[model samples]
Structure formats: C-alpha cells, structure tokens
Target: MLYFLPEPPEYAPPPRAVRVPAKLSVRVFPEVIAMSHPYELAPTRPLSFERERGITEVRFQGGLAHVEVRLPGRDVEAERLVLLQAVAEAGLPVLLIKLHPGSVSFALPDAAIAERAERLLLGRGYIYAMERDLALISICAGAMRDLSGVMAGLYDTMDKAGIRVAQTGDSHDALFALISGTNAEHSARLLRQTFGLPEGGTSC
Candidate 1:
C-alpha cells in the first residue's frame, strides 16, 4: 500500500493599514532663517524718474592728467602691452583706460604720477600725449544704466554751460566726464542745478 500526502494551502498575510494625521502643524522662524541667510531687501515701490531715478549727487575730482599712447605700427597690440607693462612696473595706478585701433588712453590721479608716467613713456620712446590740469566730474546715481537719456542730458548740460569734456567713462552707478580743472567747480555747480541736487554736495 502507498501513502498519499497533500500540500497545505498557501498562507496569505493581511494587508497593513497606514496611519495619517488629520491635522499637520508646521512652525517657521523668520528671524532664524534671515540670520542664516542674510540679504538686502529690495525697495517696495518701483523706481520712478521723479523720485528714485536721476542723479543723486555731483562730485568733482581735480588734479588728474589724461594720457594717450599712440602705437601706429602693425604690432600695435604688442607695443600696447609693453607700454601697459611698463606703467604697471612703475607702481602707477591708471584709471578709465580706453583702447583704440592704434592707441590707448588713461588718466593719472595727480600731477606727480603724471610726470612719472611721462618719464616712463619718454624712456621707452613711445609716442604719447599728456593733458594736465584735468578734473573728473562724477554724476552719481543709483542704477545709472537703467536711466534713459542720462548721458544725453549730461552732455547737453555741459555744452550749454560751455564746459569742454575731454574724455568720459561710466560705471554701474555713475557717469564720469573729464573736464578742465578750471571749469570743474562751474561744471559741478551746473550739474547739481540741472540734476536738482543740493548746492552743498561733496566735491574734492
């Protein structure tokens, strides 16, 4: 006789029930978050031409010299580099550098530095021009690039006042014009009046 064995039925586990909270509470600390990540808040009101836009101040900086180096040959780039390297080696600080096809121009802070730069150029045999007794008129504002017609207005004002601008430069917040030192005070005053700034603003 043969014994018959039958396999038992497969066991099945019951499904698990998940528990979820009916109400969830979240706490936020603004001061702690701000302390962790510091940043400046933007102005609530949009920038306006009447209030927030336009020139904020007028500054006059005198006793600067404008120098232009002319490199007329085909190796203008190399000559320009050599000239700039010489200036750097002399421990001279140049500002408002502008490059041309065969020339480079910049401003020296004072007459003493200008003289030193002139000596360096003369020693190197570079053809250059140096204009002394120049002043930089800075039209200071917030976000100057965003303001339309600022440059035009400034040029118009200067032209009307018979102030001759030798060179010009700009930053994000200010527009600069190099003018005669003799006219710096007059230019500053006229710019202040045109831009509606106070008469007692800072000038040096």
Candidate 2:
C-alpha cells in the first residue's frame, strides 16, 4: 500500500525555472479494470514513478508512448491501442488506473507559464474567463503600430480600470497563471470588462 506524507507547514516551493522531462501517471478506474487488465502488462525497464499531486507519474529515460483514453461508451480498444503505441514508441512505463469524474485539474507551478498555457488553450478553443489576481486582456495586431502598441494597449486598459499592474511582459508562448480556484464565467467577464472587448470576442 502507498502512503501520502503530510505537506510541509507554510512551505511552498518555487516553480521550476526550466522544463524537465517527467512521466504522467494516469489513474484507471475500477469500472474500466476489466477492459484494461486483459492487455499484456509490460514492465518498462528503468521506469521511475514519482508522486505528484496525489498521482504516480511514470517516467522513463527516453522515448515513451502518448496514450489516450476515450470517454465512456466510446470505443475503448481503439483508444487503448492509441495509448499503447505512444508508450511503446516512447519507451516509457505504463500505468493504468481508474478515476472518478471531475477528479483531474491541470496545475502549473509558475504564474507566467500558466498564463501562456491559458493562451494556448484559448487558441485551441478553450474559452478564457477572469482571474481575480490576474486579468486577461486581448490585443489585435492590425490595431497596433508595433510591440509598444501592445504594451500601450495593456497600460491603457489598466489605467482606465484604476488597477495598477506591478509586473507585466511578453510571455513568449508561455501560459499565465492567474488566481487559483477561479471559475470560468467570472474569469471571462472580468477579461471582457477590463479589455473593453465586445460580446463573443476572444480573450487570452
């Protein structure tokens, strides 16, 4: 049996400066046990498991599979094979476990990185909402003269709202982390009001 240790009191580690390769351990649920167990279990040599946020992520030296599991009632075998091929190609350890609905949430240690991630998600059709600690703004290229235009736009928005921006800059394809535990709708409304965006305009 595995045991989780108590968290350190009043201690929060700073985010990693550089990206490091790590394995992601996905939980497989009991209902799907029958479906998953039938496949031959392979032990990936040198596969190392790390516990992060209550999940065991399996990491390997190099080359691992990119596994995908579909939603329930969808084709399971097809999805399993997709996952298998990804793992086999990558040469990483495989972990299959079951999980309850709404049990997973992506987390980033760095605030700036989180912001960039939100932007990527926004580009991929994930709607941007508001964040209490961080405000999301939208700037169009054609409306601006140059990089300064973008900064000026940001300043203008902040100045109009009577909100002071302590630190701001270009994330360079990174995700921004606003306030933790904020809802989608509230996040969206905040962005709209702050940036003077019209209805249905995208936010990042």
| Candidate number achieving the greatest lDDT relative to the actual structure | 1
lDDT of 2: 0.36
The C-alpha RMSD in Å for every predicted model, in order, reads 8.1, 30.7
Error (Å) of candidate 2 at residue 54 is: 44
lDDT tens digits, residue span 80-186, model 1 = 88878988999999999998888999999999999999999888888898999999989988778888877888899999988888899999889999999999999
RMSD of 2: 30.7
Tens digit per residue, CA lDDT, model 2, 1-204? 999999879977897799766987875433432344677444444544632221111111111111122323355555444434543454433222222241212223334544554554444443233222333222333222222434554455446645554223234321122222222234334444544555464222
In model 2, the worst 10-residue window by lDDT is: 54-63
At residue 46, give the lDDT of candidate 2.
57
Error of 2 at 201 (Å): 2.2
Off by over 4 Å in 1: 1-52, 202-204
